[model samples]
Target chain A: MSPTSSLQPLERVRVAVDCMGGDHGPSVTLPACRAFLASHPNAEVLLVGTEESLRPAAGWSRCTLVPASEVIEMDDAVEVALRRKRDSSMRVAIAQLKADDEGHAAADVSVSAGNTGALMAVARYVLKTFAGIDRPAIAALLPNARGGFTKVLDLGANVDCTAEHLLQFAVMGSALVSALDGKDEPSVGLLNIGEEAIKGSETIKRAGELLRAAAAAGQLNFHGNVEGNDIFKGTTDLVVCDGFVGNVALKTSEGLAGMLTQMIKQEFSRTPMSKLAALVALPVLNRFKARVDHRRYSGGALLGLRGLVFKAHGSSDAFAFERALERAYDAARNRLLDRVHDRIRDTPAVLPTAPDEPAAAHAA
Target chain B: MSPTSSLQPLERVRVAVDCMGGDHGPSVTLPACRAFLASHPNAEVLLVGTEESLRPAAGWSRCTLVPASEVIEMDDAVEVALRRKRDSSMRVAIAQLKADDEGHAAADVSVSAGNTGALMAVARYVLKTFAGIDRPAIAALLPNARGGFTKVLDLGANVDCTAEHLLQFAVMGSALVSALDGKDEPSVGLLNIGEEAIKGSETIKRAGELLRAAAAAGQLNFHGNVEGNDIFKGTTDLVVCDGFVGNVALKTSEGLAGMLTQMIKQEFSRTPMSKLAALVALPVLNRFKARVDHRRYSGGALLGLRGLVFKAHGSSDAFAFERALERAYDAARNRLLDRVHDRIRDTPAVLPTAPDEPAAAHAA
Candidate 1:
């Protein structure tokens, strides 16, 4: 908790929303903003889009409209978003987090539902990165067997990573989990092919050595190497890997879950008896469905930036969009930026200056 | 099917079985062999194990006891299995596939449910790769939404791969799918993070160029690039990737499926009302379960070798082991080895002579 949070109890969390982003645009964002404001008593929203697009949320309680002329389409290339779409709603929304002359950012955090490649490019250009951090990574939560989440980093940001970059990811991920989950020390696991240190590729083996060194210095709570199954088994609170492998694992799980759900529906609607059984088992089935529903976990935090930003799924519905807003608000409310700074400062041995050009240059 | 297969109608498939390889040892393999023989009339079995372990099946019809003095434990290292345990059952069973002095092989194919690392090492050491092939790869089947299986290669055989190696994997996978599915030209997809040709790492981009060139020459039915979800979506007949990414994707899917299955069981047994509902929904649930059952797809073929070797899961039961046996029989019956050799000969441009050194050295 912030030191002034208790002293000034009325301090509301301010979130800047990109209303012209995602598949549904204002159709989803307007409704999500209304519901979010209704639920969070101490909250405010800055709706960022064109004048026409923000008309729906005009004059609403605790809502302000910040007008921008352009919008970044879901299929826009990173170069288009960077060099061409200068006044895009996504860019304007992220700019709201920049510190003003008084050292106060216009909004505490920003949330968007847009193209991931474009979003990362815009966010990095505007906010830059924390000192000693070469590139930012995407970190998200995956539900585990313990009914909690396992934080995974570099989801789809940097395809190729060095051992030092992986060490930076671990530090950033540890701080995110510590801030969001309110855990003082979160155990971090390096994703590998086996539990032994000698497993995985050359990069992974070198990463294991760095993580152990960080653990020995009491800067990180590093567990030993873990396999893919260990992510769901909840062997550690956080799992870190190169973006390429992490992206494959994330998408593979999504594919399997989608297939299983479809098969269940197909099986239950096969015959008259099965239809009758479906009615009798509707409650249990819904409960099971809700437990594994991916919509509840819709936000991916862009960590290692100077300001806080959250990216929701581009195809998110109203309910899922609301979840993303809640996540961004919670992150800002918990002082995640300060926690990340503290973690980087504590792990000075592993954190290094840029070895080469930034990986962000390859986002295009 | 082979031309000789039709003319020599009475030709039976001969399979060498390492009965003491899996967790249950003879307890699982003996019954699986019995069941396999009962279902496959035109089949013969050569049981390889210690004399005491093979005694139980001595009087069984169409069964021969091939005695071995040692057993390779599930935890044994690759060096132990290669240099020390030369007389092990796993080694003897694979040896059955070697051609004899009479220009005829002792067994048509070999099946084992032993440690994957040890199996790959011993098999590669004994069988060696084909003339142009540098390393052997583990190819396994995964159930897809099309109501069929997708053949994935290099599951855990070679961790670090080059562009040429991935191209080799594509040719080998194409042949495996062609033989098993009876498709004249099964589509081959290179696993990547995005569908665009310019996406992914430098190695992937180079591999894409090789695959496209082979496709232009009519050597392969290349489906361009595919993302991870395409594997379960059945976008193509085969998905090729480096062993590191492939292994993580496979194991992650397994972990998610296991978690969801457990959650369903827990929900169904939570209360008396839910338990009654479960009883009514039993038939439908069982149908759904049977569709997604992992046991029916247990065999993993070690492709690119001089001899045929199929690896079953170490923890398989009687039913799963039988599936592995049936797969091996089908492959032998379909002349998978000849198809692989034909594909390699056709795509000579992408299949280069050994690049640097063989990747099999890193398997240990």
Candidate 2:
């Protein structure tokens, strides 16, 4: 029987959520979880946080509360989260996923809106990396011109990565798009300054060679090198880069989008005449805003771990947080972990050997 | 006496224009030059290209045609431009800046909308680097939230940069901003993934430390590490980064802006109701467009060069090319090169030494 065959269509998909992790605490997460349970009749949530904070969700039937005494602050360091806060809502939620019985995890997936460094550290400590994978990458969906989303990683986990690590990211990213988006063979693009072969630094050029070999071996659908603009152009289904570059690109886009929105608002409210004009243009502007709404694309998967985990924006409200829950539910329902395992297992020979020395020291 | 005092306020500012460059060649450049000469009574133009292509402006006084035999194709390799196209318009224009009369440069500045790599290669070989500066950076102006522009570099020049190189870029950028914007001490922010002290790659972290030292020594007005979004937020007057990151950030912003503009248009044209709404909002939309117009910020300076050279967008129209010429004229009029020289000279003790070995191999 298949791994997912044990559950019927009407059977519940269990999700462990850290309700006290984000800036809003239970205020945002509790409502989001309630909405998620209301929509997904076959899904149940294990709310992991202090009993006092989660008191509001006591009346919900499909949602159960699991108390955790400690809280991981938004600015807490990784060492503190990893060693000190063993019972943090973030950690306890991840633990539920790890408490496997007969080779099966308890919760189908776990999610949090905690400090990224702390969350990654706790998740990695609890679930550990999948076999043959050295690092876990943070993958997020970016809106493209085709009215679709492109998957880009590593968003900020592993600040320094090797050529081998980049190759692994490509395989994982490809597997992700294939599983979630239902693409048979997702195209992967290596993020670089220029599309030319002679461009970029030594590490990037070396990564290109490894990616080419994988494509030649039928491991991935490599679309060759792509510039930053390609991320929004939908030139490829997946874009892979080291965390440093990916984080900068992601944050830069956010900054620019925020500025543009603010500028538009300022323009419409500059004068009484413009305010009247804004009323006439309200429908068009609202449509444009809904098209590029950040609430619609709120979840980012923490890939390569043995168990599934999704990260929501720390400042996300009820609507945005609910989208994160939906993303986790979709990934769990689609057997994202199994798909990743199958891809990795099939491409054993194509995987590059990790360097003997640590890659961080050599990263300039 | 000041070098500029010889020429009074109404005296001519000689400009070497590559008439046979960009997509439209003479069709765009000739008209742009004519418009530029008409606006600035103290400006003279030396139209550099084959005489046949530049025949349209033959009868204009104060507009001289300098004949060049060959043309640098938009796709020509740097080697092709440097070796084979010896008498090309791009090279001849740069040569005008190098040809000194009584120890004074012939042209105040040269403007080109040619192949960037080819132009940079030719300019560097002909004019050479400024004293104490290694690689010349490509500096461009990005629109900020304050209705002003932030100067950013290196857009795509040096792909791999050392900590010392970053320090040089900061000094040059600060000088440029101070001269143009008339700020006593223009704030310089080093671009990175996080604002925290312990974030980013080794090169970036080291650059941060050096920048801090420069700040302590009163050599630069350092604003510390800034994230990508800070570029649009107007967090600093100048953002300095390695070419790879800067180029990706810049191109990504352009792609996003273009996509948003296209999406807005698509939304308006989708249905008759939205179309009518768009017509009502046309005034406000046009105002927004004028505020963030790319044509107004077309020129990017090749900083740290012994001589001044500006790169215009290859697809620039006459209006855009005229804006570029205006930018060059402003920099020349404000004595931008002299300001850069003064800052570099004053901060001799604070400058970092170039590493003994090449830094490219360690670039991640």
The prediction achieving the highest lDDT against the true structure is 1
B1-364, model 2: which lDDT tens digit per residue?
Answer: 1122232222457889998889889999988999999999889888999989988898998887999999999999999999999999999998877644344556878899998999999999987876678899999999899878899999889877998899999989987786567675889999998898789989999999989998888888999999999999999999999898888888888878888999999998989988998888889899999988888897699988767789999999999999999988887776677667667766666653333211110111
DockQ of each: 0.76, 0.72
Look at candidate 1 and tell me the lDDT of residue A114. 90
**Chain A of model 2, TM-score against the native?**
0.92
Question: Which run of 10 residues does model 2 chain A get worst, by summed lDDT?
Answer: A355-364
Query: For residue A23, what is the lDDT in candidate 1?
Result: 95
Candidate 1: where is the Cα deviation over 4 Å?
A: A1-10, A353-364, B1-10, B353-364
Clash counts for all predictions: 0, 0
Model 2 per-residue lDDT tens digits across residues A155-215: 9887768888888899888878866787767999999989997799788898999889978
**Across residues A1-364, which tens digit of lDDT does each residue of candidate 1 receive?**
2221222112688899999899999999999999999999889999999999888887899998999999999999999999999999999999988876556677878999999999999999998988767899999899999999999988989988999889999988988887778776789999888888988899999999999999988878899888888888788999999999899899888888888898999899999999999999999999999988888897699999888889999999999999999988888777677667667766778685334222121111
Using TM-score as the measure, which candidate wins? 1
The CAPRI quality class of candidate 1 comes to medium
